[model samples]
Target: MDFVLVHGTTQSPAGWDRVAKLLRAAGHRAIAVDLLTPADLPVEGYAQHARDQYDGERPVVVAHSGTGVLLPAIAEALDARAMTWVAAYIPDFSGGRSLRDEVVELFAPEWIGVDPTADPAKASEFLFHDCDPETEHLALDSLRLFSPAVLAAHRAGPAPEIPSTVIVPTRDRTLKPEWMRQAARDRLGVTALEIDAGHCPHMSRPAEIAGILTGHA
Candidate 1:
């Protein structure tokens, strides 16, 4: 099956490199998308950019972190086959809250703002505690700043009606695993699949992440 990987905000498609490599090695096609900044456009535009990258194949869309908010629109656009969330922020549209509001309420105040990438040490500690030093360094160096507008954006419509799975990293320091479980159940109506890794599982545990994507786990 074709898999389109959508990364979280402030992240480049390179974040999915290891997972994509593993998927390709397993004979599955993978497309890691570099999401466009919503900027002045409606937040749905981000989903449109993701859909535009598709070549008409009904793909299993795997979204990581903040990009999970775009799944409903992307799935609506492509009639996606399925979706998987990796340590992602599942939007609660019912609460009438914007993504930025949800994030601010969820994380510590110090973690919010223009860019956490500016502090490589803190970023690495929070995002890559389970990863090796080399991998952590690479991730920190490649980090980018997301536009504030992206955070302020709200979902344009209801959640997509489709088969979905949530992959929760039990060791994630950034997003608590229990919180992910509750959010998945409350918002997405699905029980999360737990992994023994941190927030960036594709970087720390690519083979296992691929296994889940391929339905082998």
Candidate 2:
């Protein structure tokens, strides 16, 4: 099966290198997308970009972190066989507030000017704590800044009708595992598969993550 991996806002396609390698070694196709910037596009536009990049038949769409909000749209556009959320945000629009508002409310003053690309050390501490030295350095060096507008956009649509699974990082320091479990159940209506790693398990535990994706876990 083909797997289309969509990275998070602060990340590039490079982040999926390890996992993609493992997937291919296991005899499956893995395509990682470097999402277009300014990332100001609506969910539909993002989905179109994903569809344009993938030219395979019924690939499974996987999203990580903030990009999870675009999974439903991307899956629908590509006619994906399944969807996977890897330490990703499961959108809930019941609060009648945009994602940006929730982010501002959650992080307050610090979220405004915080740039992961500009501060590799801070990014390492938060996002790549469990990764090896080389992987962590690569992540820091390849970090990219996402448009603030992307955070504010609301996921305004019904959930896609596809088989979905949520992979939760039990050791994640960025997004708590408990929160992810609740979000997976409440929003995605699926029980999460807990893994022993940080936020970026694709980098930290590539073999294990690959196993999960390939139905070995």
Candidate 3:
């Protein structure tokens, strides 16, 4: 399958270097993109950045973190498949509540904290619990504060209406694991597969992530 791995906030496609290799070793073509939500651009720009990179190739799209907000629209454009990783999948894009809905709020506050400084230690402790210090620092250093609109316009925007999968990191501290399960169930209406890993499993647990991808159609 031709797969595009969409990253979350403060991330670059470079993080998937190991995961990409894993996918190829298993005979699948994969590309990880550096979304346009540079630390400078508003969060809204990240969606556009992803939209520009989202092509219907191989018919599969995998999105992580903030990029989840854009997947519904971008995947719609490609008529492709999608897999969301510990991210939001809201619905009702026409200015009201979305056609999709979820109870991600359950895991908020404890696991995920919003600090403006983008502290690497705090972020790593929450997002990349299992990753090494250097890798974790690299990941945190890439983060930037996103627009409130990204979270604000959420329920008011379209949700991805495609065959999809949601990977919930059971050990996730960044976004609550309960939220991940709730998001998967309430939005996609599927039982999420739990993995013993952190927020960026494709980085910390690439081989396991790949196994799930291959296990799917």
RMSD of each: 2.2, 2.4, 4.1
Candidate 3 error regions (>4 Å): 37-48, 54-56, 86-107, 110-117, 133-148, 156-160
lDDT of 3 by residue, 1-217 (tens): 8777766554667666777788889888877766554364444555456657755454577777656766665565555665544344434344355313332453345544466235666667766778777766655655555434454345544444577677877777666677667667766677888888877787777788888877774
Q: What is the C-alpha lDDT profile of model 2 across 1-217, one tens digit per residue?
A: 8999998878888888989998898899999987765536777788888888988988888888777777888889999999999988777745445566556433324334567788887778777889888888877865776554654676456666788889999877666678789878877788999999987888889888888988922
Is 1 or 2 the stronger prediction by lDDT? 2
Candidate 2 vs candidate 3, TM-score winner: 2
Which wins on lDDT, candidate 1 or candidate 3? 1
The runs of at least 3 residues in candidate 2 whose Cα sits more than 4 Å from the true structure, single-residue gaps closed, are 93-96, 104-113
Give lDDT per model, in order.
0.77, 0.79, 0.63
Q: Which regions of candidate 1 fall more than 4 Å away from where they truly are? A: 37-39, 108-110
Candidate 1 worst ten-residue window by lDDT: 105-114
Clashing pairs in 3: 10-142, 10-143, 72-160, 91-98, 91-99, 92-98, 92-99, 93-156, 93-157, 126-174
Residue 175: error of model 2 in Å? 1.6
| RMSD from true fold, candidate 3 | 4.1
Candidates ranked by lDDT, best first?
A: 2, 1, 3
Per-residue lDDT for 1-217 in model 1, tens only?
8898987765678888888998989888999876765454455676677777888578888888776767677766767889888988887757767676677555545556535577777777777778898887767765775553654567535677878889999888776678789988988788899999988898888889999999832
Ten-residue stretch with the least lDDT total in model 3: 98-107
